[model samples]
Target: MFDLDLWREIFQSINKNKTRAALSGFTVAFAIMLFTILFGIANGLENTFEKFFLTTADNALTIRSGTTSKPYKGLQIGRLITYANKDLDYLKKEFGDKIQYITPKLSRTYQLKYKKRKGEYTITGVSPDHQYLEKAVIIKGRFINERDVKNKDKVIAIGRLVEKDLFVKESALGKYIDLEGVVYKVVGVFSDNGGDEQERTIYTGYTTIQRLYLATDEIGSITIGYNPNMSADQALVLVQEITAKLKSRYDVAPNDQRAVRIGNRILQEKKRLDNMTTGLGILIPIIGFGTLIAGILGISNIMIFIVKERTKEIGIRKALGASPRSIVSIILLESILITAFAGYVGLLIGVGVLEAIGSSIERYWITNPSVKPSIVYTATIVLVIAGAIAGFLPAKKASKIKPIVALRNG
Candidate 1:
């Protein structure tokens, strides 16, 4: 099993055609390297995209009422949709602590003024929990609190853009801003310096705005934040149950003409992104494995050719009382050595490249595209399997060769 002479002979054969052997080994190595690199980069890109999405309230779920599609029981299908404050109350009572944070929002565009300085702005009426839901960064003073909603305080939190336009170098905190001749205190300023700031949006307590601006006890929409441990499917089921109860209490049809609208856009988007990442991860390996198979085929073919060309030498060994199994083992060992050594070299090169380029690549969904140790270990296992497969057929053929026929060819 441990014949020194057989190993020496196998080495001698490979050393004689160093260029050919090197080329075959390199082919396998390069394929595996390329496969690892491509997949790693794809993962990095996905990471960056996910980060961008998260910065804008990753966990927020909005429920916007949409017009009914079909006329139910001869009633008009195109009725204006609305959800009342009572509906929110009902949902709050039913779900309780199952819902982490909930808020009703009413958004409208209006001209905002601080003395002579006036600008068009989007006003949002939201509860104190809206601050937690959006993770809104307050640059100055404080956000709307429970007291503001209770007292119906005409207080507002202005975006950074509004401060730049109206206040200029003046301090924004505790300053009064006019909304349609009604004065409201600027309790906070947001550091949203992008297009969100430039649009000059204002946030106020939801109940305050509902009393002042909107005449009805209805809300424009509801925002909800579910418990992190709950799956999207679980949340959806809860929401559906709440909707059913609300419909029954309101004396509305199951497929109600006045049904409340609810949606989890964040959950849907997150699921899509996850699926995409998983697909890319799986696809890259499959393609890489194909390349590895190609390299193995090349190695196998060359080994077969080596066996055929060395027929005379093999026949002489058999004539000298070398067993068939020994001949097969010698050839198989040579094939495995070539494959494993070349594969290691290739893996090192690929990993080095990833290390070099990882930091330079822009942050994506798959940040820092480096090969994991597990991945390398997996590749090593693949190399071993490929090496064995490459050697097997050639070794089998060499074992079948008779001493007489092989010696005559020589």
Candidate 2:
């Protein structure tokens, strides 16, 4: 089925109309380029969102108190609501086995100083499990441990930004810093986050903070890290059950309820981003296929024109004992050759553009935009289908032309 004469004729015909051919090729290439860029952007956004969520926490829940206005079911309004240490103790005593990690935090704003350098930061008094709940990565030294909390040691883990400001050109670990006149030794330095590192924070042991600051038996908030296998809904339900039990035991009204506030918004946002990416993934292929169809149509139109121009040549070949199948094959081959070459060029250009642009747009949510191999393979298949379809109609038409009619036209 490989005819040298057919290939020669197809090549000659395409070479004769280089400008029109180039225009058609450009159309296909441009469409493919647009499709590739769209796919890359969607992919980048999804990756960034995932990274942002991971940097925060994993399978963790947060609890906060909120003011309620209306009295509900015999409960009085305007009550000062708070979740106490006793409530936390009760929850842990009842559901210790079900929980993975728990941290009770007491936060306050204070000026942190080391020698002459001073900056304001949020000072958080947290238990040992706080590091696990927040997924805090210790860049230097070690985070506050159980010994620090148990002994009520005046030790702190500082964020990277705070270390840079308070202890410039020196290791912050083993250095003593003042937190509102209370001396605390820096045990670890954490990574910088969301800019303004010095303005970010430092964490210390809960009992140490309580003892040093003379605020015993009081906590600001509680963060709970549940088992990875547990769903957010399940964690929330457990928190609700714990809250109800605590309220009943304390004889507190529903409006005066001390309840856990689960913070699973990051997970929710991640799921939303994933769904959006999936939709875009489906959409990109449809657009790419549509462009391919248009390119095929252009090839078909050119093939039809080629058939008309070569009518007498085709007729003479037939008259001289050429088979109808051979005549059809020549026309089909020309159309397919043009479409295949143009599609390939388009695909290459599109991929090249993606590679070039992907590097410059790195962010937490939209990093490293690149096309998947599966998508590339699928597009290649589409191009082949387009080439075949583009050639089919023109080949069939050429085969039907009679020698007498074609001769008359010549």
Candidate 3:
């Protein structure tokens, strides 16, 4: 299998036509390079989309009340619509198992102080279920439980950044922090993947906020987690039913969009995922055909030309008692070597480019751009196969040429 003289002749042939080999290799390398970069960018975009969606729970939905924009049933336009504790009870009584975790949110800005280090951060009043809705991971202590909510306890769950900001190097757990004028014990410290803004806020019992701030049973918004097993269409229908029923209950106009707005994270995520799938479905074939296949064709065409250029050499070898199979093997081996090496070089260059620019492209919403090795390797194999076919056609013809005819042509 190790034929030294055969390889020596092959290398000698390549050395004699360095320019042709270089040009052929360049075509393949360019195609593979372009192919790799495009796929890498696509993968990066996918990563960004996933990261963006993961900031909130996929099954969570938020319903916020706003001012009525239209007159209905003698109620004037611009009437402020608001949620309350009674609304939460009505939903549970009506929907029951359709709703998983429901929590009323009351948000406010309060001056938080811990030993003179004061900062105005968003203080949101939420129930224990809020932890799952906002994807909060409790790093210390625990979130608000039923006992805390029922008792209207003045305990707070601070975010990681909140603890870091006020507590300095010390832990905020079990420490009392002054909120405006009232001192609330920091019962827990939590982290969120939703970034700094989310991590800067603090959470406490909604009942505590309702009693302390409003002295009433009013809420700003309601967050609901639907049953995960519900289909996307079913979830959407549930949201519509809830919205329509709420508007009717509040005597708001049916067409008024501003009075009640619901945001379904799962719906948004599904649409985005579907669009991404469709886009990739269209894009992959386009890239595969436009770049990789083009490269394979280029390699095939160049191999054909290379065989033609060596027509007289093939003839001379045949005349010197060389077998037809030997002539074909030499040409085929040269084609494979050039295709494989050039394709690999292109792969390396493409990966290097992605690595170099990956961080810089994050602003462009492309994160960790890189191609799968299997894709590049598959493309290379395709190119090598094409090269073999190209060499075979011309090499087959050259092997049949008469010595006289080859000599005359040369």
Candidate 4:
């Protein structure tokens, strides 16, 4: 297998025609490098979307009440669709297993005050699962628990902006705060990606809000978490069913689509992701293989020229009884070595370029933008297979070179 003579001949051929050899190698290398970078760009976009979507629960949906837009069953068209504690209970009991976590939202206006600092924020009433819907990170203390909701605890989880504005330099943990002249202890200081306004928001227990402030069953909206494994179609179905149930209970006309507003963000987002994936599926191959096929064609053409140039010499070898298989192997070995070496060079350049800008890309574009080892290995395998295909026709054509044909061509 250690064919020194074959390698020596290969090198001799390259040395004889340096320009042609460089062109051949450069074609392969450029193709690999360009293709690799394009692949990285595709994957980086994918990573960027994944990071953004992960900020919110993949299966989370928010529902808001709306007024009837059409008259039905003796009801006026302007009937307001309202959701309350009992509505949540009814939905929970009706769609028990289908619903993962359902939380009612009742926005309360409070003059947020701690010591001398005071700010006004719409304190939202939420359950423990509200954290999942909002994806808040608790930096100081724990999020709301079931006990806090059930026992009507006078506690709150304020966002980072709230912490900074009200508490200033001091920590807000275990600190008593006033909301609308009522004292409540801060249990957690959280942060979200939703900018300064979102950070200014705070969470209070649903029961506490209803009992202490509103003194009535009044809810502005509801958030429902679907099972993580639910597909876009399934989520759409659930939303339709829930919307129908709510419309029926509230006596909104069946045809009044505006009475019950549903937001299937998970399904919408999933569909968008699927569309993006499909577009990339069509794009990547068209671009990557387009470059690769150019390289392959160049390799094939170069090999054909090499075979043609060596016609007289090959004829002499055939005269000496050299086997056709030897001729085919010789041409194939040279093609493989050229393509493999070019690919390796391209691999180094591609990796170096990515390493240089990886951090900058991740900071702004994607969370982590890097090619996987499997992708590199797959490229290598492609190089080998492409090398074989590039050399195949030339090798076969050269192999069929009868002494007369070679002599005549010469």
Q: Provide the TM-score for each candidate, comma-separated.
A: 0.61, 0.67, 0.79, 0.78
Candidate 2, run of 10 with poorest lDDT: 253-262
CA lDDT of each candidate? Answer: 0.75, 0.71, 0.88, 0.80
Please give, for residues 1-410, the per-residue lDDT of candidate 1 as tens digits.
Answer: 67788789879978997986787677667866775787667767676656656444555677767565556565666665677777677778888877788888888888888878998888899888887777677989998898997888999998887898999999899999888878899999986523564336899988877888787778888887777667656766766876777555644468763455666666777667656767877887787777767766766677667777778888998999988888878777777777778777777888888878888766434577866656755765676676666666766777678899889986
Candidate scoring better on lDDT of 2 and 3: 3
Please write out the lDDT profile of model 3 over residues 1-410, one tens digit for every residue: 79999899889978988998899889888888888898898888888777776877777889998999999999899999999999999998889899999999989998999997989899999989999989999999999888889999999999999999999999999999999899899999999999999999899999999889999999989999988888777888999999999999999999999999998766767766757757886887697668877887788788878887777787688789988899899998888888889999999999999999999999988889998999988887888888888889888888888877876665
On lDDT, the leading prediction is: 3
Question: Model 3: residues >4 Å from true position, as ranges?
Answer: 47-61, 69-79, 89-101, 111-119, 145-154, 174-187, 193-195, 211-217, 225-239, 263-277, 352-369, 392-410
Off by over 4 Å in 4: 1-13, 44-48, 51-55, 69-71, 265-273, 286-294, 307-337, 344-377, 388-410
lDDT (0-100) at residue 281 of candidate 3? Answer: 69
Which of the two, 1 or 3, has more TM-score? 3
Query: Which ten contiguous residues of candidate 1 have the minimum total lDDT?
Result: 191-200
Candidate 4 structure quality by residue, lDDT tens digits, 216-318: 7778788888876776778888988988888888888777878899887666878788678779879987998887777667777777787777777678778
Order the numbered candidates by TM-score, best leading. 3, 4, 2, 1
Q: What ranges in model 1 sit over 4 Å off? A: 1-32, 48-59, 65-81, 169-171, 191-194, 197-199, 264-273, 280-410
Q: Mark the regions of model 2 whose C-alpha exceeds 4 Å error after superposition.
A: 1-12, 23-27, 44-55, 58-60, 66-81, 84-101, 128-136, 180-182, 197-199, 225-252, 255-378, 385-410
After superposition of all CA atoms, the RMSD between model 2 and the true structure is: 5.9
